[model samples]
Target: MNVELRYLRALVAVVDAETFTDAAIELGTSQAAVSRSIAALEQALGLRILQRTTRSFTPTPVGERIIAHARRVLDELALLERVAGDHGSELRVGYAWSALGRRTIALQRQWEELHPDVSLVWVQSNAPSGGLADGSADVAVRRRPLTEGRFTSTPIGAEARFAALAASDTLARRRVLRMADFAGRTIAVDRRTGTTSEELWPEESRPAGFRPVQGVDEWLTLISTGQALGMSSEATAAQNPRPGVAYRPVRDAPPIEVFLACWRDDPSPLVADFIRLARAAYLPG
Candidate 1:
């Protein structure tokens, strides 16, 4: 109930090094401190984490699981530190897939011209939060609405949907496509970060099956193999052009709404300016 990161670190260090003396050395602390930390951890958890002998020690069954969780916690902490450390002179913007399509370069150039002292960095992440929740970015451009109350989002613009298909597929010959056209074919979908879903089509005309994928490259690869088809915003079509894949406008599918998001409690000072630029980029010129 009252576990601390230091105690968990000591337990892991002792288990990995096989001795309190080695763990202390690895942790850059005294052996007595390491031993006490482990004991405190065990007391707090009400469980013995290690099986120790006179010469060696190993993690108990439950200790292995706890240690794994501790490693993940530590890893996340390290990531947070790295992201926070770089916040001094950089404005990191995150996106799930394709950024702003043809407008990405224009936005970057404009930002550089306006604020030469601050570097405008774009980070592409596959998570639904687009790296905002993980502290990898100060702001995020997302195609879907985030329901969490800890974040605030505003609609920037919308992008038309496009169908991705293999070059050799019969549908590729069409100048445009419709949601119902691929009702009997399998579809590749990235459930976490993608804009495509069965809900895009009428229930009666849904795809025959859905193949799961993690990122844009994987979705494109699956489609290029002629194994499945995919649907995404026009931005993806413009940014990622695979030789074996063809993108056709999906005339009937609803356009995907785009939103700019940031932490509700600690938004970046540059978020307003970034949002303004993004809205301008998405506007019809």
Candidate 2:
């Protein structure tokens, strides 16, 4: 079967955007073009890749495998283009949310001073692997480590947990909070990319309810609106300071461990250097 790169791109865009209309907007093409690409791809593969319903679009089992490979291929193709075009060396570091919080700039500056020949690029992606699995980044910084064997992870540093509440909530007055303090509140979480989970608390005293959100913005919105509270790493507290939302240290909660990860078979040469600098950046001066 002759499968083109545009077909793969269309497949990924549709999946990421969750609809052909949105995928078209993302790809700068018409909705009909996106639809045709998907159909052409399916015809070439001779199998159903996506399950579409009135409410949602999701990948079939086989489509999931195909999409994963597609991401890797597209990533490699991008690298090839950069090399062929003589683009200078760059290390793309991906993160789902804040990249090292307040230390992001310090790390970037240090990297530039040490390796002026190579540009340090930060790519923000909402993927669970922080863009590694999707091939958007050469390396990734994550609070939740990837379990896939194809990936290798290194521990960089840990940050204390924090509680996020509506500024007007009575609990917002506290200077610090404990895990138990959240037991009575509804907790908002981004199950895909966020570090927090209901399991953090003892089963019996867990939050009143766990509401899953799509991303950090949604999580913060829920907290800020008094619809729910949230738990996250100190990095989040430092990186995102939304109005109507108050962040307080969760004194008794366990610290959130940070990790640097990359594909094991084709790891970036700068991964080690990046890890060393990241660790130093996270250090208390």
Candidate 3:
């Protein structure tokens, strides 16, 4: 039939209240209006749904069957509304390990204050590949500039690699070191996981006899033992400079660029707000 939801709601209210006046009060309408709605609903369905006397209203056998199904439909509509509202209000943010420093955390706090309606979730990854491709995250902070055409990126900041060595190491005496200084040195490199090509020294260019370490923690241990030196981003160097470790800038090395990346198709307001905060926090005046 062509009956609308309002008609069904009116029918249920009338059946529950057992009087047109009471149903009108429940539906926020006049008694006459409620009666007209019921009459129209009956005409559309080609069945008398209610039995009415001056003192009372009662549901017919056909009306009882329809009311059961109508209640189910109304419940489903309420659930659909809630699901849509939740999906519209939530956002997932992703970042590389080096990207989640004090500054980025502060930016997240500021963004939340400004957009209280949107929920911000933080995700961390070591890979340069942004998480949007796999849907693990909605927005990402990538250390290496994104080459994937599917994502939209904004330059956040520039990062650089620094050599970390034991203070007793000979290279530690220099104010800064060049890539060539690493020649003949037993260098520790992260080879176990998330090693992007840019983070690696080309096989031909790497120091002869350099050893690859399997984990970040293992690399740190190797460096601490005074047996090997390792390279890390400036942010990581700043955070974890041990007593025996010296951090020096790596001169003549290509700079690592950081970007805020998001799916090209995501139209979430929360993502937009976070991007705005990141630009303000990282961009130079």
Candidate 4:
């Protein structure tokens, strides 16, 4: 097939993003353009690449094979570009729980002022590295430090931890809390992206148990219904804002560290700029 790299990129973006519209958002193009790119690609190969249903979309048997190869090709291209010291016009900022939360808007505005030629795209993933390890993001912002030798990073800011409770809960009226206050509570925590852990408590006084939630929305839903309480970074409160949930400062809880990380071997010039911007944006007055 005479497929071009851009066409393959669009195809993979669609599948990874899970919709034509979302793929377009990531690719910085119109949904119609992304749809046309897929259609043209299928025509070139004489095979359908996607199977669409009313509620969702997925790759077909043939499409899955194509997608796998496309991803590999794109990854190689990215590596090549990185090695060549190319900071492309677009940068994808990946995150899990929250992408700088209340700082997001100011950061974006300042980023535009600092680098008007480059476009920034925020991509959310619940992966351990916020999709950086899987090549879905060029760089990532996460609360966890990058421990692997392959990655290098700097701390941008630290967010104060908060205790999330149902609005009707007795604790909701309190302005602040301590680790000891959560002794008998069953707390909901996201296994993948969350920074909170039962370890915050002493062995004997840890929360009654943990309710493992895979995503922030699920954590909020569980907390809202009083099935579980949650302790999380202040960013979670600023970003999610569920009606039934209230976030109070955890006076004695440890703060969550935030970092901007990228592959140490890649040498992407944009990573430095991102790290710098994040630091400046998050610095307290």
Task: State which candidate, 1 or 2, has the greater TM-score.
Answer: 2
Q: Sort the predicted structures by lDDT, highest score first.
A: 2, 1, 4, 3
Worst 10 residues of 3 by lDDT: 190-199
Between prediction 2 and prediction 4, the one with superior lDDT is 2
If both were scored by lDDT, which would come out higher, candidate 2 or candidate 3? 2
Candidate 2 structure quality by residue, lDDT tens digits, 1-285: 989999998898787666786567556579999889999999999999999888788899999999999877876775664344234578889887678988888899999998899899999877666776445677888897788776888888999998999999999888998888887789998776788887899876688899988678889988989999999988899999999999999888999999998777664457778899998877887
Candidate 3 per-residue C-alpha lDDT over 1-285 given as tens digits, one digit per residue, 9 for 90 to 100 = 788877776776676556676566545578888888888889999998888777776778988898888766654564454346447766667654455454756776786789787777776543333345334467787665566564678787776778889899988899999878776777776532322233366555676565766445667778888988777677667556577888898887776666788755445566677777877776666
Candidate 3 colliding pairs = none
Each model's TM-score?
A: 0.73, 0.80, 0.55, 0.71
TM-score of 4: 0.71
Clashing pairs in 1: none
Error of 1 at 26 (Å): 28
List runs of model 2 lying over 4 Å from the truth.
9-38, 47-89
Better candidate by lDDT, 1 or 2: 2
RMSD to the true structure for each prediction, in A, is 10.1, 4.2, 21.3, 7.5
Error of 1 at 92 (Å): 0.5
lDDT of 4 by residue, 70-188 (tens): 87787677677655534467788988878898989998998889889988889887656576655668889988887767577778889999889999999988888888889888999
Q: Which candidate number maximizes lDDT? A: 2
Candidate 4's C-alpha lDDT? 0.82
